[model samples]
Target: MNDINREFVSHDEALARAEAGVAKLAATRNDRWYPKFHIASNGGWINDPNGLCYYRGRWHVYYQLHPYSTQWGSCHWGHVSSDDMITWKREPIAFAPSLEADRDGVFSGSAVTGDDGRLWVFYTGHRWANGVDDADDNLEVQCAAVSDDGVHFEKLGVIIDNPKGFRHFRDPKVWKQDGMWYMVFGMSTADARGEVLLYSSENMRIWHFEQVLFRHPNPGVYMLECPDFFPVTDKDGNEKWVIGFSAMGSKPSGFMNRNANNAGYMIGTWEPGGQFTPETEFRLWDCGHNFYAPQSFNTVAGDTDDNTDGRQIMYGWYSPFVQPIPLDDEGWCGQLTLPREVFLGEDGDIHTVPAAEMAGLREDSTDLGVVEVKSGTETVVAENAEAMEIEMTIDLKNTTADRAGIKVHATPDGSYTYVAYDDQIGGIVLDRQANAFGDRGYRVAPLTADELAADQLTLRIYVDRGSVEVYVNDGHQTMSSYSYAADGPRAVKLVAESGDLTVASLTLHNLKSIGLE
Candidate 1:
């Protein structure tokens, strides 16, 4: 017998193992750095938000999960459901590495409602040739699981075998458009060039290869993972399509692509089973250090309610791959970025804003009206900085500072993460080198001339226990990263580096916990 056969377990046994592991960790896990509102794993590790869809009046989100340890291992699908997208309830583990096709692991994929009124999930079944998890030499194929109630899934085995001449193939994002089912798979040619392969099916089971939807122009990018394609309407009522994926082996350029891996998207035009023609160059989805593998909710799938309202809502893995996560020793690591509504901008680009339902989390509100800071001074905006939501507008027309913005997770010992607009670089900078845990570096989000011409810069920031997500100018740009302070009594401060600046308006809101504990 082969090594995989020797190690394989029945579906029931696999699920029991996962549940026992989670139960053991729950009894003694630490909550020091657990997020107050974000979707984090109960224990162990999670990455790559998968199988996002609006089904039966609830938002269903599945993720790549490894429940036995706080590290990456053989994968299972972790499940959660929400009625309003703000408060979530954990569901049973969805998929596990049980069958021969998935003896090694279950990777990332998407979900769609089948014609038979069942929720169908399509994912990659991975097996390493050397019989070791995460080994470089492996085989991957597309697989499916179906559920009538969205809680229990029945494995359908392999759906699409590995295609020839592809060294890497995985991450199937499936959707329906114009009465046909279409799927996109991230693949790398045997020659090591990254491309997105398109396929179509009248029914969800049988798929036929169409053509290459899009390819990375840069040969340096060896592979693209977690590809998502969706349509959005712009402010002028012009419809456009967007292609997004996470790029591995992407070289760093200035302040972009600095993370170990980067996620980006291109605005383009694509028809059902047709070629995708790009209208804009590739752009980073979030100019931050820890955002990747974003998946959008399929609003048209299943029996979705009017709450979605045809919005392209998305969630990303809020942790960087191949980086140190400080909370691993505490028995859990990784989180999901807040749900963002993506739309096509008038400038022919994609922009994301926090979902409207997020306002429901606000509790006590304080309006710190019209605060000004001198050239060499700083003003404390809020003393209770932990678990807060802050919105502020800086009057750039009347500002003369070289650098002006807010400092979050600030400690009295001169340690804080700074988010500011730098006049010298003409970009927004997120600096976390001052006594923060994990990776420490700065990232810049460059502004276009049109953006700089505007007289004000609006910022909406969410500060959790160990992370901060900043939305700039209503999500024309965003930065999401983990920043943990070593000392307590952290405060939020507004500072001017070289010259005076005026704050036209500022408000702080104490957000309520989602009761994840």
Candidate 2:
């Protein structure tokens, strides 16, 4: 591979070789993936994880590269390769938005290994043919790039041409079945409805539109983005199709108090020639707010298991709609949700439980069972630990605090979240303590004030060396973030402004990354 963006220069010598355009992002401070050697500088904007496929004895990942600017300008395909999907090696620029068909930028898509062993990437080609560079010309088309070796790709011209109908369709996910290939692209239709365009390809080349796999039932409102279909098997020893997509829309109330972006899954059977038996219904892929744009690679590639769910894992961009910080200084913006193990759980829902690989990063462990705190009381820090989760249940009967609950990563003096049951305000308040970025992140996402008025708080919070996630009441409510190092900790602090409370129980755990050395 050659340095395609030679004109672009970076401050760091090691990062300079990356062919990346932006400076190192101090976006994350702690263990948020600043390897002494590896090259993802820091912060800016990173979207769609493109060209995700299990190839060359490793999982090769290509993404829309905005390594230079943060606002989605002139994207090149950034490269990263990983054998175990944990530690990633940054590769050189694979492809950019140079072709006339993709002047606006090369959009999100998938990579598939052709029957001939060559890797063929099917992606959305964004262009403005009218010679106008305005935002209105962002038309969508399908294009391909083939790689004899998984690292480098060559433009293969347009494959599936854009036809008339919907204006909002894009992001094609391609895969093979019995020597032939198929693609599912998301789009908006003439009827103002969202649909997934299904297309077929022979010899991994010339294409044909098969049929409309799915539509957003509702018109004009629900535009689908990032449609992916993978094969899974049920306990009855039957093969099923898991077609999933993100419903791009505004935030709703309740759990919908989220910023923006959400994903869902449908697990039914696909008969290629016949119709797809849609799963009983669609369910949220991740109830959490940050997860979006999930792509999978068949870990057990080519296995003939009747129960086909291998490590069909997923990775998503954790998007916080109202960012606490700006992107101008930090050249990068987002981080991927720790890879998750995806499969149909007992309840017939696509269970996206965290990957077991994360357990390996555990450094130390502790537990506090049934802590008791009088009004205005807090615990002193115990022995230090790293990469952990603190699980606890509280009974705040007759409590008077306008605030109360466990304080995560609580420093000696600051940086904590006061999860409180406020009788005065009548809601749950996530009072975040002041930190390096200041205390701007504190905001209240209302909870069920009626159901839980009984004075009970059960919280399960995970504090990784670099990231933090709070899963309230067994995943019903969750908050996630990449906390800086100086600010990351495994300490526990409990407080209530008005009265005494009993900590029903507490358990601390050491966490780690799986399949990683």
Candidate 3:
């Protein structure tokens, strides 16, 4: 399957090849590190979610798939579809590296529904013609494929080549606006700074070069990989654009430092002439350790509503840059974050919460109603639930505790993942060193005074087999990280570290496995 000259003459030929690759996944189904509620590869490596969209009547999600092994190589588009974003059905491979143009790999891209109800995917076609050289040495081009029934795809061939003088260009994110389709590709200048190029297509075939969307002012060690642009409006109905990209090289200052590569977004306005005038600096988009290359999709189907108030849901790769996954030996290496709903505030601030569909996984319930804890005390709210969802409101206004919040995956041997709010520092601290598989550390995000009240610290936490995701105050802020807990009974605890703490309300729901089903 790794042979570059392998060719699939028809759709059936490609589907057969995909079936062979997925057949080996059953042996690793019982691995301890495999995620219970996330989308992961059947038997290979998956990274950088591609072509995420709602097509026909179901939600389709595509990811960078390396089918032959648990390591990176020539990639294809692995397909998964769901009625709701929570539970998914693994479809056959959507796009394979079978054509001569994309013989090496079919890289990251986005999906769009056409005017005539057809589905089109614009992806980066890559080939390893030369050995690893500078970014220009790799032959990268933007290619297109179309599907009539949202399953079988016909390669429409390369739509846009490397028009920029620099040779590094790929990852075409396409969206329709004002009767024309617009695309933005991730690229870098000759000096190696990250950049994005824009193009417009009157029809799906011919494309016209627009302009460079944005470039770094300083040419340090930086090359942007994935570029995503979409519009968001706050509660006040003021609209703005969110420009996002995955950055590599030296980490940008003020962003999260858990990983060297940071994925971020810029809040700004897209001018009439295609210039992005920023109102705020580039900010960390997801306050998590293993989140990157997030692609947002419009929920409406083709030629339907204008998508003015649709949900801004995004899915991201849940793996760090160079860290090896615990399940690599079992022949799979990556998983996707749970779908998150992004919210833009009136003042141009951004936050993300779990998608509403995740509620469907709740099965049984535990109610720890209105508990109170004194200083230096902790209480177990729920126990013996490996996969569960917990929600509570901490009265930060009435409490004088230096730190008070929830602890998850707590074991009898004094090991747990800690998520606490420190009023002394006015920030949330996510400490996972006790249970993390790799170089674990504490990650923090600021909690502003405006977000705190005597009885208003809303917290939502989702804990699965191997990961924990926290959403604060309906996504006013979020902290997501991965941890590998031991095999034993687990307890969820709420502690008041310094002073008195009051829980206005608390509820826990045992969640069924979204993948095992």
Could you tell me every candidate's TM-score relative to the true structure? 0.96, 0.76, 0.92
lDDT of 3 by residue, 1-517 (tens): 1233235455467657866875676455545657778888777888999988887667889999887777777788888888666678888788877666576788999999987679998998787656443343677788888998767888777788766545568889998888888999888777788887889988978999889888855466357778988888868787789888887674545535457677888888894456987778767766777778889887863635443237877988876454645656766677888888887865458888788888888888778788898999998887765888888888766777999888888877777888888887777788877874554677777777677543578888888777788887777777777766766777888889879888889999888777632
Q: Write the per-residue lDDT of candidate 2 for residues 306-375, one digit (tens) a residue.
A: 3233677666665534455443334455556655666654444455555565554445656677777778
| Candidate no. 3 TM-score | 0.92
lDDT head-to-head 1 vs 2, winner: 1
lDDT tens digits by residue: candidate 1, 80-190: 998888788999888889877677789999998888989999999888866774456678889888988888988887778886725579999988778888889899888
The candidate, 1 or 3, that scores higher on lDDT is: 1
* Model 1 misplaced stretches (Cα beyond 4 Å): 1-8, 133-136
TM-score of 1: 0.96
The per-model lDDT (C-alpha) reads 0.85, 0.61, 0.77
Task: Give the CA lDDT, 0 to 100, for residue 475 in model 1.
Answer: 91
> Ranking by lDDT, best first?
1, 3, 2
Per-candidate clashes come to 0, 24, 1
